[model samples]
Target chain A: MMAVARAKSRKADEANNPSSQVLRFGADKPLILEAGVKLAPFQIAYETYGELNADKSNAVLICHALTGDQYVASTNPVTGKPGWWEVLIGPGKIIDTNRFFVISPNVIGSCLGSTGPASTNPATGKPYGLDLPIITIRDMVRAQAMLVDHFGIDQLFCVIGGSMGGMQVLEWTSTYPDRVFSALPMATGTRHSAQNIAFYEAGRQAVMADPNWRGGKYIEAGVRPEKGLAVARMIAHITYLSEVALHRKFGRNLQDRQKLTFSFDADFQIESYLRHQGMTFVDRFDANSYLYLSRAMDYFDMAADHDGQLAAAFKNTKTRFCVVSFTSDWHFPTEESRALVHALNASGAPVSFVEIETDRGHDAFLLDEPELFSAIGGFVASAARAKGLA
Target chain B: MSVNSNPRIDLQVVADLIPDNAKVLDVGCSDGELLELLRNQKNIDGRGVEISQRGVNECVARGLSVIQGDADTDLVYYPDNSFDYALLSQTLQATRNPRAVLEHLLRIGEHAIVSFPNFGHWSVRTSLFFNGRMPVTKDLPYSWYDTPNIHFCTIRDFVVLCDEVGAKVEKAVAINANGQKMGFSMPWWFWNFFGQQAVFLLRR
Candidate 1:
């Protein structure tokens, strides 16, 4: 019944937004999800750049962080803005679309065209909403693996990502160690820190607090829950940046006011900036999808899959690894990257670590940091040499 | 030691001591010149830890797999028996606890190759005895205020440190101020008195 409702919801969503590029898969060989539910008749929306070599060894998978979509090096269909990672993934950029085929997909539970809470249930014929089973990072990777399998590629030359995307990179490497030639997990940790979980909880509460949410049935109830989603994005955005970055970007400067009028109407420049950020975000993103994706991030724990020994996740893994972190990123600091390096060393896996000197915080990987690019480019070139690619 | 005829003369000896295709960790590997040589000449799998950011950048630019890390704190990250040899060329003197560093090196690798400028060379003694000031020889050229060699020791002192740390000296060689390797038949005391630097291969 819920599946039928989901199918109906998907049809309604399709009618509302007719340009969702998707790849459909039958339920014959469902990607076994962590929740023990075999989802079939599912679809994954993805965008690819460059050409896959005859051997398919030059394929590179670029996973995305929270709120990032598959439009990696192209214009976003929803926002009309350039791709999120344009700096890192382009024709001659660090990831080098000219040299390697890059694939970016909207993860399993996201607002971007991929199957998520907004996606219809094949059984219930309505949006899955609360009916959709909560997903984990491993589940997200499993879906991506299915997408990779569809392309008939035996092994990827490299898999790289930052933040939540980095979590997927690690999950993919651990779950299918032999399939990934090299792995780069930047600005991420093996497990969600307690503080991060608290932040996510705050975001979730903010969404649930709005009456327009209508118990997550707002779409069918003719409401958008914009206020709740905006508040959630506001709180979540603060975590993606550092105090140093915020101070530098907005400081205490007033917004369009000569002096302190002292009205709560965004009296500070930072307040006006965050409000603008929150408002623009709701225009393109869905509320329920945000909740589901946030939960997935919270559920991620790599060591849990290996019986509490993180090193065991990469036991004798032949895949080379390069872990990266920024100095001022308090959310995912260099210490987390060192822990990852320590685990790789314990597993006897060959690994390289670079703690880039940056004050841009956790969002540094998505920015123009020359050191990050050089480190990544150098690692990729060396790995290519090892893989016998020119 | 800037006064030495060639700072790399001791590195040449270290490169020769290492076998082909061996797994080596070069701690405090500034600029990774030795690692690059080992990779090309001996086909060894080399990794490096350098303290300075500039050194790491140079190593990376040269296609060396090096991480920016201090030897005093980062050695604990490497697993025991992970490398066939651990090299600390001209770096042991700069460490805060030389004995602990040596012990960690022995535990992490099958053998530890260490080289340091010997403070007991005759020139250093002459400066102390006559000038009543710290040596300004080719090997120990820096003024006391600017010197980074905080735990300077001689060949005899290092041998005693090895003994106390339960590390057996597999081999030893001393290079004179002219950068010539001293004869193996020469007593360690003779090398201590005349040689400007000493290199030792130690094992637990």
Candidate 2:
């Protein structure tokens, strides 16, 4: 089955004219990690919405959340759906594609044409599976920096993302503060809490419990652990929402008919919603990639480099930061964002924080919230004007 | 020269009160216009603390050295006696803990310039007494529920609070709504009769 998928992908690549392509940078290969492992020939899949200006000052990097692809404002060829962030990025939208060069890349450890667990290892010509080197958020930012350097962008007008994408945005500022002029890290924390890591652990356990998984070699064994992957996605989806949002969106409501079937089938609207979420997620994502990405998130502790003082991590940062969080996102609560703000304040860094009132949970950053749009739009516009882009 | 270039308060009053070449901190320094005036006109070495990111960006765009920080929570980062004067023009009333903050300003600077809306002015007083509701005057635009000015203070109330904190007043100037200076004798009535704002220079 693995060989068949590869053959199908090759045939599709040859038969179907390329509508889009991922641009490469650096030495055309992945660099070795500090963990004493080499990840060679890794590629980044990216999509661009607008033309780069002559001076390249209009370049803006847009980081995508977990499970999100590089398609920012274009239609995704896989699902035949509109871009995930179409509402925020368009000709005249808040992000304003007409005025900015937007780049969204499928992050490393993701399955969308990027090197991940599912990608074949050149050494053995088989999927890396559990053998893929554990990549960190900083590693992702380093790859992105290479991409930005390839584009000849000396200074990014702004780096913007939310959730895991927001984590990358923070990393870009800390690791390459001179390159990033402004940063908008929305609905993200400096590090994943123990509770968050526990959730990821539970999801991984759910996937491994399925017999078809066969210890992460299901693809080589010619079997797909769809049920296990779906269940894992279902459990993870529950964490991405707030209790208020769940109550408002589904409130013990029945799925089709008013009466409960009293059976094992999905009886409540939330249960049906979870089932749909799980089934759709399994279709596009690789299960092993999910494990790798979640582990990467669990290991993400930005302050560990600064001697356990989060404020010290930003002492030398000169990038203007706009930290935003939703009121009802309990997964990465407003308190978490406040902690980041407190650190920035202690470091004497220029920072602005706005906890917008919303019941959209952690995913509010992706939705069509007028308040979020206005805050980001206003911040970016001001930052651009300061950089003389306007 | 232009109507838009005029300061929100009496420019001459601020200039007269702020000493020449004194290190000054301006909270809520919108657009850095006041800071620009202090730098070019008064020749004061001015630093600003503005809450709005847009405001801070504008300040930086104008080549002014300003930090983006909230006066309510970010002021404690500064060391004691960091500046000769801390100016809170039309911003003290908006703070969550105005009394404690005024004490902090006095502790952080040799002197403090505290200015706010005269809530006990005739119009606001009448509005609440006669109309039986929160006043929505020019100085206070939002309704009570949404207003950022959580602690409304009057000129007389401020003077009493300053006395209680052992802060001596160097100069107290009240201005009419038209920005004209009012005489000291019954200035509240004169302010009620004509003035709209007040500025106080205090010494600890």
Candidate 3:
């Protein structure tokens, strides 16, 4: 009877949200998640590029940041924009598609065809809403492990990501020390700072206060909390940029005019930019998924797992790490990355760090900056040669 | 077609000084040119510590073992006697602390080979005397303000410092800027008057 109800609930979700693309895999099959709650009949959405070698030693797993889906190098049907990291994941790009078998999965608690609040509950015949068990970054990694197993890959050549994606990269190395050969965690922290959590809380409050939220049951009512989600996106977007970048891009500039209109109509260029950002973001992302993912980030604390010693977390790791940060990124400053490097060095792990100079803020990792690209390109190439992958 | 075949490196000189099939570490190993020559031509196991990511990448791409690290900070990571020789050809003057770094290098490897531009060369002296400014010669291209060569020393100054620090000079080879051997039969004053660079093999 439980199986029948789960099938019915899945069918309802399918009717409401159509898949942008089919989920495909190789010979080995997906494993059931082991978080105690049986997502028995749950499915993961992922995309792959390049061919798997006969020895299967060339696979690289890319963990995506918050609001990123599995379509890494493909078109986002909703936004019609190129893949979030198309610059870094093509045929001859740094993470070369021709040489690496790459896999990127839509993380759990996301809206891109993954199990989340929008996913239906088997028992209630409705959305999970507030009923879904709270998940942590480690839980997301555990789910990804199931996907890794499905590919029959025992070890990954490298696990790469940035920002929230970087959190998953660190978790991969810590949780599965023997399974990762190299890790590239860029523009990220070992734990979210108190200030970051405060911003997340503000965004959550904005979404929850909306009348259309309907106590997290707006899905059944056919109502969308667009206004609150936009506000939340606007606030979070400010954190993604650096003060230097803001000053350089839009410093006291009037919006499409030489002078202010003397009214509250987004007269400043920065305000207009923020409004566009908020409006465009609401077109694709689910408000409830945003709340859940941010909460997951808030709960992440790598040092807590090692008896309050950050070095202890990496004591047994044999994985070579390349921890990168940007100089202008106040979000995850170079100090945080240096702390991770220091911890790795204290634990006797082979680690390297590069704090690249750039005004692109935290988003520098995603852009086509020549220096960052060259650094990553060079590091991966060197690691590949060391592993005999070249 | 190997990059090691460049005319700039004194292959025969470095070859005679470096023992065959020895563990070697080279600093400022630009493009892994010298390390590759040592590995393929001399049967030595070579590693390097380079500051430039591109240079380190090139080394690795050529199948060389090199770490991307600053010699200023990363040298302490290695244990004592980690290599048979630590080669710092034409790179010693560019380091942050030439004296202290040489001591560390000698402690890390059984022998250390250091080569640098002799600031007391006759052409430099002539240029400074006549022009009344820092000389921009063939070897040291940058002016005083922008030059990375912070610890420029004359051959006599380096020898005196080595003696003061109790470092034994195993072998010394003075060469002109074009990498030709200088005749040792001449007086020290005459040699210092003409020699452009000097390479020294030291042991503690």
* DockQ of each two-chain model: 0.52, 0.15, 0.13
Candidate RMSDs in Å, in order, are: 3.8, 6.1, 6.4
Q: Across the candidates, what are chain A's individual TM-scores?
A: 0.94, 0.93, 0.92
Model 1 C-alpha RMSD to native: 3.8
In order of the candidates, what TM-score does chain B achieve?
A: 0.95, 0.90, 0.90
- The Cα error of candidate 1 at residue A121, in Å, is 1.2
Off by over 4 Å in 2: A1-20, A23-30, A34-36, B1-97, B106-112, B118-172, B183-196, B201-204
Best by DockQ: 1
The top-ranked prediction according to TM-score is: 1
Ranking, DockQ, top scorer first = 1, 2, 3
Residue A341 CA error for candidate 1 (Å)?
A: 0.9
Error of 2 at A285 (Å): 0.4
Expressed as tens digits, the lDDT of each residue in A190-307 for candidate 1 is 8888888898898889889999888888777856778888988998888878898889988899899888886679889999888998988877777888898888888888788789
Using lDDT, give the best candidate's number: 1
Query: Each prediction's interface RMSD?
Result: 1.9, 6.1, 4.7
lDDT per residue, candidate 3, A1-390, as tens digits?
675345434434542353543343323443233345545344567778898888888989999988888878988755668888999997988889999999888887787776777777656888887777776788778778888887899999999999999999999999999999989899998999998899999999999998999989987886778789999999998988988999999999998888878899999989999999998887678888899899988888899878888988887788877777888898788778867876775565656566677898988888888777766776688679768996
Clashing pairs in 3: none
Candidate lDDT values, in order: 0.84, 0.77, 0.78
- DockQ of candidate 3 relative to the true structure: 0.13
**Model 2 lDDT tens row, A79-170:** 66899999999899988999999988778777776677777766787777888898778888887887787788899988989988988998
